[model samples]
Target: MKKLLIVSLGIIGVILVLSPWILILFGRNQLHDHDIPQQEQLVDDREKHLILAIFPHPDDEVTVSGTLMKLKEEGHEIQMVCLTRGEKGKSSGIEDEVELAKLRTVEMKNAAELIGADHLHLLDYPDSGLEKVGLDSLKKIVGELIAEVDPDVLISYDSKVGLYGHPDHRLTGRAVEEVFLEKRGMDGFTPQEMFQVTLCKKQIKIALKLSSSFQKNYPEDPKQGLPRPDFSINTRKFFPRTLQVMQAHQTQQEVLKDLMPFHDKVPTWIYSRIFDREYFREVK
Candidate 1:
């Protein structure tokens, strides 16, 4: 009886250690079984096209890095405007806000370079506090960027969905939308396409189930509508570059530490299951 008890405890320990690996293998196999088709239609008239992506924080850009890489490869000039330097973001070690902001700025620049972005506009809004910014102020800043870049394509968060319901994200989305709407009919200000960075409801549900970190950060709220993706880019080909872009944000390592085990050990197939596609909603 004593030996049996010892064996049971040993088995539990082994299972605890191996469970994450098991889940990753299972996920990879499932992805292999259910293959999704890649989008092959290229952009029309690609000569000297410009794209601008606006997001609330430095790391927020990772969500769309795959799509950005694809656009870059297709020869469209890309730029990113990060509203804040992420001064209020969590740091791996103890650091003051000013120091953290400078670190995140460098990290964001490295990430933008990896994605082949032509320019990175870093705004001075307070991190995690964008909601406090007045609407006029928000509009003025984004409007100036739009005028300067005159982007052919614009990408931003969805105000309605507000990925993870972050206040900064919501505010950024609203501001972008307001500016885009206000400038749509003006000469040389209208973008050919406007896309909201988003995940499919199905993917979001799966992520919520699989990632405890995601759950902690974004508590499920039925009040918020789940965005239905009107467009999707199969990012399987750009997944490695996306991972590299993410890795460039070294200061935010703790933010992704939970997934590193799978990221480091699992086959790229795991990423195919997790981040194979970048989804968006077209804002007409």
Candidate 2:
């Protein structure tokens, strides 16, 4: 029994020391298996660009926070647009919707600031009820903001998958695409590129197989595969700041726990080794 215990302890110690490297290998393998595209060559970092993000809720920005921080470091302006305050969900244990709204707004502002966002535009739309707002109405509201920002690049959730198949995410993505494609280069809205936040299909499959927490939780999506990412921004240097941006939304811990299960349990280096890059697909 003593010899068996000693051997088990040695094995555990080896795993503890090698886990980070193993995770890095796994991450690289996933990146390779998915055939993730390289960074776009035409994107000139020397020329300043206004990058705007549109999403349905406060914490949705988490998907792109690392990239935003990196861009800000590269002398680009970052703007975030949130369609709702995320008051409808009581995941925060706050029963009062009004109070929840107030808190979520503050959290979002702090998160945006931490992510180096220059502006955060808030639309007071009903949380979790975006479809009721009417597609045309949403297009008008989002169009007005696009005209005002005149962003060089616009980013939002993947229209086909919606980053776990959220209705609000899908709707906001649809609105942004329709509004921009219909009126580009006509009404002072000259955003040249549209990028959608996404995980490559292989990555999604791997994540789903590894974590039972996400099983049976996604809404039905007609799209057969997850959206493929065309660009990957290496945020390896800014992952610490990314954690801070994530923690800024304290009230949304429940939601984050599933997405980042090891964030708190593992050291930053280990966590960053696996999630060191943010993925996006540019709409052609």
Candidate 3:
């Protein structure tokens, strides 16, 4: 009994000594901007502009929903486009693709309504088969959409890595970025800036633990963590709206809960501490 007690005490002492070192080494968040008060100077409160986001799936816009709400409150128009209704994805063991497609479209619309998106465009594109649609064709369609919207700001995922290396997401982001490049300096019009959604190294590490989708899709390169965000949007002021947006996509509850297991079960403030910051890399 005494030997066991000594061993336990020694283990506790080692943990206590290594606690700060462990946190310092492993718990360091890879965000480029630390504790930005509310928002970046990129957005001016006085000027009204249109913000547009294009994603492959219904729930993808949740990434920037808080920023959308903030922009809306400041009198900016928000428009979200989903290239696919996420029919190819599984949710809650639902296997009927056609049924899930319709259901997801409805959920997307509901979330768009809650986001106060002035326009919610749901396009029917093959979900997981975006690559099959081919890049040039996708670019033509995306370019036209951008031309029509004529947004001041554009949003999409990281083209190279697509956050966690989702193939559809990569295609969507590549299409958006390529279109933006083509339209830039055109005679017509183009967005002043484009921002790509990204998760930091630490965030992806946490996500791998929670979501099997991420674990499977994430690159096997041990060194290839998600890019460090160029800046962080402090969305703490509008976390309530963010939570509502998260809840709007009931079909994606598993994905949301993976990030925060007790998200809605606990007080909103508790989760806001981790989620209040939205990360992005500005597209040049």
Candidate 4:
């Protein structure tokens, strides 16, 4: 009787442990269900320029890569600034921060290359320790990088970075905002008014609407308990390229495959865009 009781208890424990993952899988299917929508925007004739993306980790780029890929296809120079090496991710057989960071870096570079991006700058900050980094110091580093890249448009984590709410994402956002102010150049600025290419309320609202459907489908997502975001990018034109790029991150394949299984079911050219408001600050 005692042995049978022990077996029953073990099964219960296993179920409890796997409950979160099961719930997440269900939510993922819902999140990946939609076909990308088409969004039409009048393009202004201007000299081609760069769009800079600042992210806290390697995979963070995947969340917004669709828009970046679209912009690149449209001929905008794309660059990325990653803040950490993602050493904190657990390894089943491999363990060691130094080695893990190096491995992750290689993976990140490959992912970037797949998207035709040639410029990538890593800040070498400690993973999960971004909040501890002084705001002033972070601002200085990101500010200098921004000045060097000088992209026409910028993208990064939303104020409420999905699910994980990593501190690194918050700090990166703050640093980007500060850098914008410093570079606004009231005294030494060239633009005269402020940072150019700020996203307007209309654009932000459209993005937010797209994100609402994602949140509504995944109300049980522990990583993000919040409602839909207030901004999103129109992504139909670049969905295929984005999925291809996402598949390049082999280490994250299991999770990505489970969550983003649209590759087999959806049309390759389906339109879908990511949205975030944190990167939508007004420079002017």
lDDT to native, each model:
0.76, 0.81, 0.79, 0.58
Best by the lDDT measure: 2
Q: Residue by residue across 1-284, what tens digits does model 4's lDDT show?
A: 99999999999999988875665555433343233222332122165667787887876677667666666777777898888898886532347888878877888898788777859887698888877787788877776776676666666543444323346765676567556656665543322222112233333333345443333442244344332332334665566666777766656565454334434554343313222112222233
Where is model 2 more than 4 Å wrong at Cα? 1-19, 27-34, 40-42, 209-222
Stretches > 4 Å off in candidate 1: 1-38, 45-48, 210-223, 257-261
In terms of TM-score, which candidate is stronger, 3 or 4?
Answer: 3
Poorly placed runs, candidate 4 (over 4 Å): 1-45, 91-93, 160-164, 181-231, 254-284
Write the residue-wise lDDT of candidate 2 on 1-284 in tens digits.
99999999999999998987987787667644446655633257978999989999999999888888888888888999999999986778899999999999999999998998999998789998988998899889888898788899989986665777677887888898887778777757779888888886666776576544335544345364457777787787888988898899989887777666668988888778777788888787
Distance from true location, Cα of 273 in model 1, Å: 5.7
Q: Number of clashes in model 3?
A: 0
lDDT, candidate 3, 1-284, per-residue tens: 99999999999999988765554343234322344333554477787888889999988888888788878888898999999989876865789999889989998998899889999989999988899999999898888888888898899987887877788888889899988876788777668888898876667767788777788888888566466677778777778877777787777788777654566765565456556678888888
Ranking by lDDT: 2, 3, 1, 4
Clashes of 4: 12
Alpha-carbon lDDT of model 3: 0.79
Cα lDDT of model 1 by residue, 31-108, tens digit: 332333345422453466788999988888888888888888888888999999998877567368898899999999
